[model samples]
Target: MTEHRPVNITGLALKIPPALIFILWIAMMATLRYIFPGLNYELFLTPYVVGLFFILGIFLVLAGFFSFRKAKTTINPRKPEKTTAIVTSGIFRLSRNPMYLGFLMWVIAWAFMQANLVTFVFLPLFVFYMNRYQIIPEEKILLSQFGDIYYRYLNKVGRWL
Candidate 1:
């Protein structure tokens, strides 16, 4: 008889929820804005740009939420294994992780509102943290759960637009 070892799909990292991460990033940006007043720059259409991105972000988030609700799947990022269905309809068609993308847009909107170029540096860090700690682990569990169907969906949709 051959002995088999089960694979550890869950990641070994700080499994902070995506919403908390978003809040932390926003707070960090706010702190930076206060700490370095010289870094601020005035933009002509800051309000319009910020409003547009904020609204778009909210829309993406709601669409993603509704899609998941409609699918009767779990939206909790910390437990991808709990996801009952692979959502591939509506906003999911455009982005594999529309909710995360929405959060990213909110960050962008905050950056614009702050009008601080230095704050933009946090954007890539946000992406890196999300990909490393959150998305990758979830992807592993999802791949194990949905197999080729998930892979096909991944190949079809962009992770973020």
Candidate 2:
């Protein structure tokens, strides 16, 4: 029915690995917090944490929204669609995946501003999951759809950065 024979792993499994990685990362973060309550090593909870995250998160959200708006097809993950345009403007210039980046900002904001150990777990987990399952699969689709142009962009810009 499709052009290429589907790979051994289903999309569901591809999606779950990253989520699991994130979950494990969160667990580790929880252990760290539980074991050492006074640790502020990776915690970026300055006075600016609240406002900084607020502004940054908002920007990220807007960027993602704009990217989706500019994109040729739907952002729905269940149904894969070919993207006609390479969005290099607005937030796309900043981060390849602004929406997911926004989600990351939310995780960091929730963790630091609220000083909640449990919520903080989502930050790392989200990165792991998105990078492994979501971003990886999306890249494959993008490459297949965009071909050389997509590869050129991949070389020019990073996945997250």
Compute the lDDT for candidate 1: 0.87
Summing lDDT over every window of 10 consecutive residues in candidate 2, give the lowest-scoring window: 1-10
lDDT (C-alpha) at residue 120 in model 1: 94
TM-score against truth, every candidate: 0.92, 0.68
RMSD of each: 3.5, 5.1
Which residue pairs in candidate 2 collide? 18-129, 22-125
lDDT of 1 by residue, 10-94 (tens): 4543378899999999999989998989999999999999999999999999999999999999998877878889988899989
The sequence of per-residue lDDT tens digits that candidate 2 reaches over residues 60-131 is 877776677777555554333345566777777767777667656655755675454565656766777677
lDDT for every model? 0.87, 0.63
Which parts of model 2 have CA positions greater than 4 angstroms off?
A: 1-47, 80-82, 116-121
- Model 1 — which ten-residue stretch has the worst lDDT? 1-10
Query: For this target, which candidate reaches the highest TM-score against the unseen true structure?
Result: 1
Residue clash pairs of candidate 1: none
**Poorly placed runs, candidate 1 (over 4 Å):** 1-14
